[model samples]
Target: MSTDTLDLDDGTADRALLDARGLTLLVFTSQGCPNCRQAREALPDMNLNVDRIAWVDAGRSGGLVARYEVFHLPAMFVIRDGVYYGAVQASLAHWDISRQVALALDGYPAELP
Candidate 1:
């Protein structure tokens, strides 16, 4: 399925996640991070099952960084129907990301941060 990508901040990110009807990949990134830039370029073309990819600028989203416990640049989380599925632990490769997302969804949902 086609996925939409949004560049969101703290408040907007929170609203977008809460309003999302399908699976949403919430990614935390920073401006100077090379991995983050690669993610921005690669995510749209990746064959992921998510309906939307919500990007939160870690430099600007202190609240979200703190909430999600983001210590790295390109930290990802899976959210389905407004419930948190947990962090997505995968490489930047499309296949790895898709596989990890599927595996993450198989587990029980976590409390939204």
Candidate 2:
């Protein structure tokens, strides 16, 4: 992983995602961040509707990181219909994030909910 900081908010960063007409979960991460690496890796296993964006713009990554309070390297959230479900961290699990998505859509109100 690149030990480089990231820059979000740029038109060039790869907008890789699974998007729809509704709710989205924004995962803020950098390749150097182990946690971020995990989340990005596990994404393919979770059944979700999402629009994933990689913030490679090193200039604005810090501000975006602070705005989301993403003090950790790897982070995730449960966005429902379209709202902040909060972020969390875990070592690594195949179903951990999938479960979060389940609970979120099922009205779990999120961890912050």
Candidate 3:
């Protein structure tokens, strides 16, 4: 997948994780990762209707990792009103990435999974 990575040291602002007017979804993935591939495929079908931005870095870029407080690869972060809402993984049998986005838009707090 194509990625748009933000350069943190250039003094540019990190993309707001949440937007008060609407909600956003940020799915962190890496090349050559299988689980990330499955998540990406299932994202559209899930309840989360979000503007997806794919981050290419998998911890090698400190700026990118710290930008989102990412602790691991193949992770997900959902945001609402510029605040973090949720995260999902392939291991979550009951988890659907899109549901997190939908729930956030429906007035749920930022609930990280």
Candidate 4:
């Protein structure tokens, strides 16, 4: 199934998260980052078990960047039913991303930052 993606900024991220249902892939990305571009391209086709993909431009979303402690481009976090799960640690490969997301969801939900 095709997953929906919402472009978010610091002002809108929280509201989007609050409104999100099911699994949400919250990603911090930069426009100039090559890896971020690749992530943008790969994520839509990854077939992730997520209801939506929330894209936050790190360069412009200072609040979210600091809150999430994003240290690199294309940082990904998993959220379910408006609760924060944890960061997703995986390569850009579809299978790897899917595997990592599953592993992260199995862990306890983290306190939102």
Candidate 5:
């Protein structure tokens, strides 16, 4: 229950899990944001493991949001190997998210289906 740790559904002991994990997608969302709502809805069809992603509420996690320098809503960052890999904003499509994540993690182009 660290101050910087977020409340996760997985019951993970660590709150700073993203900074220590392999490939993690940190999605910054805000209430009443249309783009954020769209991103949430698209999550199910994105063809990615839910466990690798964390949907963070920007309002609730002000410090965490500021840590990432996320000034916009519906922003996502790919963190891997304890490094900030890359980021994408206002993504509404599954392919866009998947491609950005792949490019950040794999260092190559991702083909969409």
Candidate 6:
């Protein structure tokens, strides 16, 4: 449950939502990455749900960065139903990334009771 890494226990970003099927944005960030810092700052202002975002520190875990094939900071991967759904690469504006995230969430199927 460390804040610096993705919670991979049940493949859910938030452990409390392990049984909740929905879209998750696995955001990979690194130290000294300006773009990543910017994205982090803007994310709290976005319309995204708190549980839907996973802020992972890539610099702290090289294996994670390699596993996701991420070659840049502030990389975002969408996961739905415990599967890879989409990705938004680096070098893009925070607004653009937020838009992509919204689109991804729009496509997520509603969870069943």
The TM-scores, one per candidate, come to 0.95, 0.53, 0.53, 0.95, 0.68, 0.63
Q: Write the per-residue lDDT of candidate 6 for residues 24-49, one digit (tens) a residue.
A: 66778776999888877766556554
Better of 4 and 6 by lDDT: 4
RMSD of 3: 5.9
lDDT of each: 0.90, 0.47, 0.50, 0.89, 0.60, 0.60
Q: Model 1 clash tally?
A: 0
The TM-score measured for candidate 2 stands at: 0.53
- Scored by lDDT, model 5 comes in at 0.60
Model 4, residue 79: what's the lDDT? 90
> Per the 3 Å backbone cut-off, how many clashing residue pairs does candidate 5 have?
0
Model 4 CA lDDT for position 80: 88
- Give per-model CA RMSD: 0.9, 7.4, 5.9, 1.0, 8.3, 6.5
What's the lDDT of the predicted structure labeled candidate 4?
0.89
Q: Report model 4's TM-score to 2 decimal places.
A: 0.95
Error of 4 at 18 (Å): 1.5
Candidate number that wins on lDDT, 1 or 5: 1
Q: Point to the candidate with the largest lDDT.
A: 1
What are the per-residue Cα lDDT tens digits for candidate 4 across 5-105? Answer: 99999888887897788899999999899999999998888787788999999999899999999988899999988889899988998788888889989
lDDT of 6: 0.60
Q: What's the lDDT of the predicted structure labeled candidate 3?
A: 0.50
Summed over model 6, clashes come to 0
lDDT of 1: 0.90
Residue 27 shift from truth in candidate 3, angstroms: 1.0
